[model samples]
Target: MSTSQTEGLLQQLLQEATVVARLSGQAIISFAWLWPIRGVLYTLLHPHVILSVSRTLFTSLLTSAIIFTVLAFFTYLPQAAFLSIFTGPLGPILALLLVGAESVFLVTFFARALFLEPALSQVFDTTLVSRGQNSLVRDGKTKYASSTKKEGIEGALVRPFQALSRDGLMKYLLSLPLNFVPVIGTVAFLFINGQRGGPGWHTRYFQLKGWDSARRKRFIESRKAEYTAFGMATMLFTFIPLVGLVFSFTNTVGAALWAADIEARENLIESPRANAPNSPKTNEGDVRAKAE
Candidate 1:
């Protein structure tokens, strides 16, 4: 392309990188409260919330470990050769490939456990209380009615696999070529993966809210910008070497915080009184009339 076009592309790439960095930084800051030990403790303490999902978590970890080990073993010779010759680009490419292999499953798996289920349970329980309903019973004799139909653990367990299917698989494949593009490619990968991964964490919330597949698609599409930011931050976190595992859990907590913020905003907007601060109040009028 022409000089101006090249310069514009460079600028665009810089801007995208900046956005990813900012979002990643914000994610770290937002989730700083739940880092390391705190996040693990939170998950462990909430047995009622996390026990059902524990099997999926263990399966994901075991599968990812096996896949990562196999990939590392198979790629060792090629990776060593590449490192000896062209250590710059090929080095990162190999790392990305290996990590991506496991991350395809692990990231979604952790997101579901750390963010979706817990957040849905918390949000739904709060919603029930707001509606004058109880999720639990104080008396041993009576059980509380279910607020929402449970979709089953199998569906949640299979989500990462669904993400690896035709449509979902294509986005990841398309992002691979970008890894060769130097600095720009890395940023592009972050943006692309973040965009793809953002909505997966929200899957549990959608299911819990009783949104069917079509409605979930529509709602996610409508909030594309918000989820893109979320996904970008998550993608950046996954790019970190060792800490990414810990951050996976934190990402879930961050996702819940994000969902709670969204619900709070929606509730504020939906409240009639919140929208009409100056409107006359019947209680005030009645008290004045009684005094007069």
Candidate 2:
């Protein structure tokens, strides 16, 4: 993809990431399955390469610390007897691996927020409204119907049914087979669910703008190819070492920015251009446009 297109994808991914991060805070407090599952779903929804890197680092540290404490408790006795099973001399290695896997999961979670949910939200707009409005409302929306405010723990369990329905369940079940497929399979499964809740938010955003589901879906789907390409491009960043880590934060933002670009272009929404004021701009057209 061209630099502009790539940047656009990143923008979109980042915007979704903010939503993903907020939703994740809710998911973490709610269900056992929500964290990693939510993580993957968030990734699909957001998929900002650079931001994912920073988020991966921040979350990996936090998650690994939690994982290590839990594993340490279990592995301590076994290792003491020299019959160590899960965490012997291999503890550090395992910890590292777990953290790495977690980083990937975090990425997947964001992506889910970026892709799956918004599309489904468009499909299930009616259901989002029909599911009885709870007493609790999110910061922006008036009622449960207008916001992606999934009711806390109680709502989490029932919410899927109201929003997703049988067809969504079928699709989720069909995706279950992918979980068995070694490393990639696990990643795929994470990616699929990560897509949830997000599109609904997008739907709400569109509703605010007097847009409908079909219009929103058409706009997003048009950029699907670009989104995939953005993922592939960011895949390159993971290969680099220390510098990659530095870039990872920006890369994720870049991913979100890319998404924003798609939204802006398709919807005729105007976000601040990258070349705004002090920001560097090599794009001749952007610079010329700004100069004019």
Candidate 3:
């Protein structure tokens, strides 16, 4: 590898390391919510947690495999000569100059799919269930709350491979060599993103979960400083190598959980009146009080 390539590899490796550590940290914090074992065992063996990590890894492999196969065939194409312009230093440099097309595309797309879609579904479902329970489940005594592809392509197989597909790839592509900058800000931004995407993904989820714009905005404002601090730790971890890569995946999930917890706390803080037991009127009164 040339100097640039070597540096790129080191940066990439560090990015992966911190990503994993950040994920692990998030997971630990999530389990902490359950108290004692609820937090401990869930952190270790949660199926969704494991599946999320596996999915991230698999996505990386699939995208890479697709890119490689295409690149191999493209080199033989007659038009391939024109694409060589991207191979030299100028290509990556030019890529760096672009204001992160990859980040904008991947983060928005994946965040929408992973968090928003499901959240909307849940919201609708909860609404319907709540309505239904009012009528059916409780026989008018309780309120029923109830609620209820594409593609195309052509390419040197690899020409398309160069396309951005995921948040990781986007962040990776966006920062480019700028990540090697000696200044604290640039490097810090690059490293933290590896973990930031994860929490960011979750923030979207909370927003979808009935967190109105004002409430969501307030939570983000309150937590922004802490998130930045936590991200610094994540940046350092992602630089560790094999271990770091694993942590990166964990970091994404952990960050999401951490953000959710913060929002949860905020919600509780904003409304201190808890529902009283026994009489339905007490529950109704509590709800009224909460709204007030």
Best by lDDT: 1
Q: Over the stretch 1-292, how does candidate 1's per-residue lDDT look in tens digits?
A: 4677556645654565566555554444444323323334445555443344556445545544555555556654665455435456466565554355345544554455454444334433432232222212111012212322333234232131233344455445545555545556656675656655677755544544545679988987676656666666665554444344334444554554444445445544554663487865434322332232
Q: Candidate 1: which stretches are off by over 4 Å?
A: 1-52, 80-98, 101-154, 157-163, 211-218, 236-250, 274-292
| Counted clashes in each candidate structure | 1, 62, 43
Listed in order, each prediction's TM-score against the native is 0.54, 0.30, 0.38
lDDT of 3 by residue, 92-211 (tens): 332332223223333334433343233322322232232222111132111112211012212111011112235345445545544333344344454345334323423333423534
| Residue runs of model 2 more than 4 Å from their true location after superposition | 1-64, 67-179, 183-212, 227-252, 263-292
RMSD of 2: 17.4
Q: Which predicted model would earn the best TM-score?
A: 1
Models ranked on lDDT: 1, 3, 2
Residue pairs that clash (backbone atoms under 3 angstroms), model 1:
194-231
In the range 126-231, model 2's lDDT, one tens digit per residue, is 2222221111112213443444445331112112112134344434444444433444553443334344422322333344344445887786565333333333
